[model samples]
Target: MSLEGFLAASARGGAIPWSEELRAAREFGLSAREVEAAAFGAGLLPARYSRNAGTIGLAGQAVLHASCVAVAGCGGIGGHVIEQLARLGVGTIVAVDPDVFEESNLNRQILATVENLGLPKVEAAALRARAINPAVILRPLRARLDSRNAPSLLEGADVVADGLDTISARLELAGACARLGLPFVHAGVAGWYAQASTQAPGSSSLSDIYGHGTAPAERGVEAALGNPSFTPALAASLEAAEVCKLLLGLSGTLRGRLLHLDLLAMECAEFPI
Candidate 1:
């Protein structure tokens, strides 16, 4: 079938599930990417995200349909960030993680499940994103981000998300983004506290916030305070929102300012870098 024919058959004056479209695409020997382009070109999107059109609009939605985001670290914040990006109509997402799900990750990692306990975090992220939005292309990389390989992992991305755990790793990612001139959405969570910010090119560097080098500990206070499930989700959501804003050219972003959340005290504030 021609692209128009598939659109015509699939159209009900409303959006359809990506899985349904995928089925039709396969029957017609069409790739999901082709269907995605045709569907977006025809102003059709999954009904699940139709509500976002009011905020992002058709033009912004199209931008999202053509944008690519790279997410570093696929554990707590990384997993949830990838999830929101996929559901928000991001066309492509690259998830990088060198770890796997463990029993300890069950408390805060959204991608962690008993069934996938031993699975690579990136693989789980890919599966979850695809299940949520079949049109979303997830490139899962089972590798840690470092200066040598960060550029390659992050190449061709419009924006890179910093969901990494340690201050050192986050610093590495921010430096990489700076070098590559990519927008970096940074998020961190520990217990009831969470913070997020967007580091646009020439913006404040990560070192300004976390200092010059790696911490002596592998984890932070969160390891002692105990990270509940809600903290990572909350932090990731905030970071994801900044990414969407950057993609759509929205205003009131967290760029150059750190958004801090203290869930226990029910307080929210922003501090300039």
Candidate 2:
């Protein structure tokens, strides 16, 4: 079926009409039981969802229909960010990463399995995301994110999630989003230290905290020491949760503030932007 047809079917209580469902069952490789199960999934079927499913269901539906872009660095944080976004049902994802997997990635990178050792980070992440949700549309750009393509890639995105490492790149992306009137969530990880902030257009941004060119010495040291899955996992999950809240038009978004977490100190706090 066409992409529009698929989306239309997804809107009607998650079940396509009779002929489409039969065809999908036959040609798309989905089993009859799997089709039945999907039909009953809460976000797809209003009848199947309970009142409590409202939050997740509405969040999932909004994400399932919205288009989003993420500019990421190493697959550790980037991979986890994509995983959480896909599981939450974000429909369209554009992932930017130029790096390839290496032996050193096993400790934190989600796509860094031995089998995928030589693959491009974006490709590996796209593969994993598709495995989780076949219907998810992913545009994997295996290149560095710079000023030139940042705006184009992020254009029309309902929200932007940052898993980038470099301060320069982060500032450039944040500025680009600010110009485009997009909401952005910024996340950075180094060692057991991670920080995140959300910014709406015309609001405070990453540059506000990190400055235009000055990189934090502590953040550099943390990146040099490398990050553990434990930290990226925590940070990415929080970033994804905040993204979901923003997409669903929910209140209490982590806008205009920064949240800092230090695993060693077991301390987490929010500070003004």
Candidate 3:
């Protein structure tokens, strides 16, 4: 069947299975992602994303598949963010992290398997994303984002997510995102507490949160307490949701505000940025 005809038929069923989508892509000489995009555009959700239909909507699914996100620091939070974005069907993910997985990362880093010790974090993220959803394209960049290379590294992304562990790198990336007019989703974790925010372009929230003048603290309390496996996933989920909301043009993103979660206390609160 023609691509349009196949999509239309799938629309009647309210979703298209991956096997059929793959067959159609092969038949039409298009990439699986391209076919999935067409399927959503034609008002059908790919079976892998079917459960997301009512919540995300068909048009939103297409939008997500067409959107690209750059995740700086694919370690603790970046690893989880990349995985969630891939499963959510975010089309292109730019996974950027200079370091590699090690024995220390097995504690909280999802992409860091014992088998992958010494593997580059970005490459590990790409591998996980593919395993989760091959239709989602992940571009792994094995480099750190300094002020000079931040823009070029994060170019073409609709939103940039901050998972960098250090304050300096986060500051540079936030500045770059602001210059590019891309919304920046940021989260910081230290011990049992984590805070997340969405900084819209032109906002100095990062500098405001981190402060002006000589770098406040090179690292947050996490440096002392260490990432204890739960905080990164908590903060990363919020960041991933923020990215998803931005890509789908949904309301209620944490723009101009910050969400603080205290896992130890089991309490969460939101504060204006």
Best by TM-score: 3
The CA lDDT of each predicted structure is 0.84, 0.70, 0.87
TM-score of each candidate structure, all chains considered together: 0.92, 0.79, 0.95
TM-score, cand. 2: 0.79
Model 1 weakest 10-residue run by lDDT: 211-220
Minimal lDDT window, size 10, model 2: 43-52
User: What is the RMSD, in Å, between candidate 3 and the native fold over all Cα?
Assistant: 1.5
C-alpha lDDT (0 to 100) for residue 44 of candidate 1 = 75
Backbone atom clashes (below 3 Å) for every candidate: 0, 2, 0
Candidate 3 lDDT tens digits, 1-273: 779787767553677877888778878899888888778666678888878877887788888899999998998899999989999889999989999898999999999998999899988888798888989999999998877887788879999998899998888888878888989999999999999999999787888788665668889788888879999999999998899998877899999898889988999998887
Q: Give the alpha carbon lDDT tens digit for every residue of 96-169 in model 2.
A: 88888888888887878999888898888778877766556677888887768877766557888888766767
Q: Which stretches of model 2 miss by more than 4 angstroms?
A: 1-43, 46-54, 58-63, 211-219
Which is superior by lDDT, 1 or 3?
Answer: 3
Candidate 1 C-alpha error for residue 224, in Å: 2.3
In model 3, the clashing pairs are none
